[model samples]
Target: MYIPLFDIDGTLLKGGGGNQAHKNGGSYAFRTVYGLDDKACWDNIITDGKIDKQIILEVVEKNGISHKKALAKLDEAIDATTSYYLEHSNEGTCIAADGAIELLEELQKQNVPLGLLTGNIEAIGIDKLSKAGLAKYFEFGAFGNLALRRVDLIEIARERAIKLVGLQMTTSKFMIIGDSTLDVKCAKDGNIPVIGVSTAKSSSQELAEAGADLVVESLLQKDDIVKFILD
Candidate 1:
């Protein structure tokens, strides 16, 4: 059976106050851990398509903290970030992207094993998905806290999927569906097929250039997407 691993932020959910909630959470963490008061600290950082830990390290390092000390405080910062996001994220603002729920439902109906592969830490990702009514579709996932790179996360997810199915599935049996160039590159690097959804940052052309096997304008093209997966 083929397994599809979906990206959460832009690919599944959209236009939620989730982004603000994350920034607020990150700011709170920085304040609590590093004494940084600037709430807009992440304003200049390129956060899209990157994992939470990588973002944290970049912010702390740029603020003059040594790598060793930052690593030591990593768990502390992550906890603070997760706590704040959980407290502040508004469920009402969490909107499912166009056709996201429908496509997921169809895939579920077809008995396609679904999983999440995202840069979001587990807590925040689950919170957002729950808010968007998407958590039920995924039983397990490979989250950002597990790795700094998306490619590594793919490997981790593949291992977990194998354990879940109790089968040694080849990497080709896995597919990544996401909206960023990083998603395409990571899937390419791992030698897994990737479907790029142009629902967030990257355009279809950019995703294709990044080596995506398929580039979709949105999940609205459910028939085509479903056929691709089944084939």
Candidate 2:
């Protein structure tokens, strides 16, 4: 069986990140935890594909906060962001990407080793999936808090999946599902193929240009995606 590690925001749900509210909430967490509040500091913190610890470290150095102090408050910031996302999601969140539920459901039917490799921190990632009622599909995941680079998380997920499902996993048999060039590069850097979904801001052609192995307009495509996973 193939193991498919998924990305949450753009790949699974619409408008999951890169919005005003989430950006503000993340920035707020940094300020509250480290008292590191500067527009430039916040901007450096949550750029494309950055992890939580990386964000904290940069914010600390750029803003002159002690590294030890930032490390000490990292957990507080993490919890604060979790609270922020959970509370804000009530208005309207987790609009499952077109075909996301369908695709995940079919994958589950085949007993594919489904796991997450996402930039969302663990707390927020779990909450997003749980609130969307999609948590059951994911058996395990590599979240942003675990590693700074996305490639690192791919390896982490691969190791976990091996133990989680007893699969003799290989890169050729692994696939990363996501929506950005960063996602494509993450998998490519790990010597794995990426299945790109353009339901997010990136277009199909853009994903293809990024060297995505397959660029589908949405997961709902009737084309046998399982073939991508299995054949």
Candidate 3:
């Protein structure tokens, strides 16, 4: 019952954020409203380097929609993107993190149960993983747009994992892998161990500060990562 929940962006997927097209396009709605497209703004305000209420407000303001309305729009956008990408895969638009596939293969071989818990909406999340051929690795997942807060998705993921595995899994059986402080907080809130990877916005030191159980520089270090997680 060792359920390892992985975050796609920065954890298993690297560079430019997974499903960049979706975020980039949607972010324009915000940038157009506030002229805040700079990296510093996105890194500091939108993602908060950590999950908090300020980040939530930024998301709403950026989108030029009420939080409730934004949630609805996010759902629609995800569904649309998922359908489009699934239909038009193999164009090389979707990329997987280095060593991500190999690590997943190894985990699968060991019969370690796997699932996805991401801040990405369903359409965007499924499209990225499906395109990268990593979708099959997960038994189920929780999407960001499904709820207002990342912690809310944790329960959804927990329920899905239980249903998929047909058994109850304790927090000790859970491990969340991601690159951001947001990922760290979500896992901590869920009362699970977190494996942080510095493949996205956050660094190893930052992840450690955010309370990551283990922070690796890259998933490319397959032997070390495997040993660290499986040890």
Candidate 4:
């Protein structure tokens, strides 16, 4: 079976309608857990499709939150961010993107191996999907909470898919589907093909420039996508 690794936030659900609520929640986590309120600290950083700890570390550095102290409070800060994220998703700010449910259902019918490859901490990622009632579509995933880099997370996804789904083939047989250039880059790193969906901030043109094998405006055509991937 071909393996398809899906991204959660932008690819499946539109979290906070493109980062407003999510960023607000992260800022809250930084202040409450790390006391980072310097607006300048967050100005230069881009959090979308980023690892949970990486974002916190950037905030720590930017806000002058003693690296040592930040390290000490890493777990707590991550917890706070994830908790806030869960709260927002629970509050109905995040909803399934258009055609996302239909696409997932169609993929499931093909009996393709489905798993999540997301930057969200495993709990937060799964929680977002769970809240949207889409969690049942994924059997396993490699989450940001487990790795600090999306590239590393991709490898983790491969290993887990192998273990859980009997994914018995070279990594090239796998496909990474996501909405950001980061996803495209990591899939390239693994020598895996990436299918870009424009459900997130990246326009189809942007994702194409990033070297996505296929760029779709949205996951609206199930047969066409499934056919191309399977072929």
- Any runs in candidate 3 off by more than 4 Å, and if so which? 24-45, 48-57, 62-92, 228-231
Give the distance in Å from residue 63's predicted Cα in candidate 4 to where it truly belongs: 1.6
Each prediction's TM-score versus the true structure:
0.94, 0.84, 0.76, 0.87
Sort by lDDT, best first: 1, 4, 2, 3
User: On residues 52-161, what C-alpha lDDT tens digit does candidate 1 reach at each position?
Assistant: 99999999888878999998999999999999998888734778899998999999899888989999989999988888899999967899888877789877887887
Query: What is the Cα-based lDDT of residue 129 in candidate 1?
Result: 88
Per residue, candidate 2 scores C-alpha lDDT tens digits across 1-231 of 468888888777777442444556677787777676546676544455556667666777668877777777777777786677667756546666778788888887887878999888887777767767778898888888887577899888877777887766776677888888888988889888888888765788988998998888887873556778876
Among these predictions, the greatest TM-score belongs to 1
Q: Which ten residues in a row have the lowest lDDT in candidate 1?
A: 35-44
Residue 186, candidate 3: Cα error in Å is: 1.2
Whole-model lDDT values for every prediction: 0.86, 0.75, 0.68, 0.78
Worst 10 residues of 3 by lDDT: 48-57
Per-residue lDDT for 184-222 in model 3, tens only? 988898787888888877888999999998888877777
Better of 1 and 3 by TM-score: 1
| Clash count list over all predictions | 0, 0, 1, 0
Worst 10 residues of 4 by lDDT: 15-24
| Residue 208 lDDT, candidate 1, scale 0-100 | 92
RMSD values, in order shown? 1.6, 2.9, 4.6, 2.4
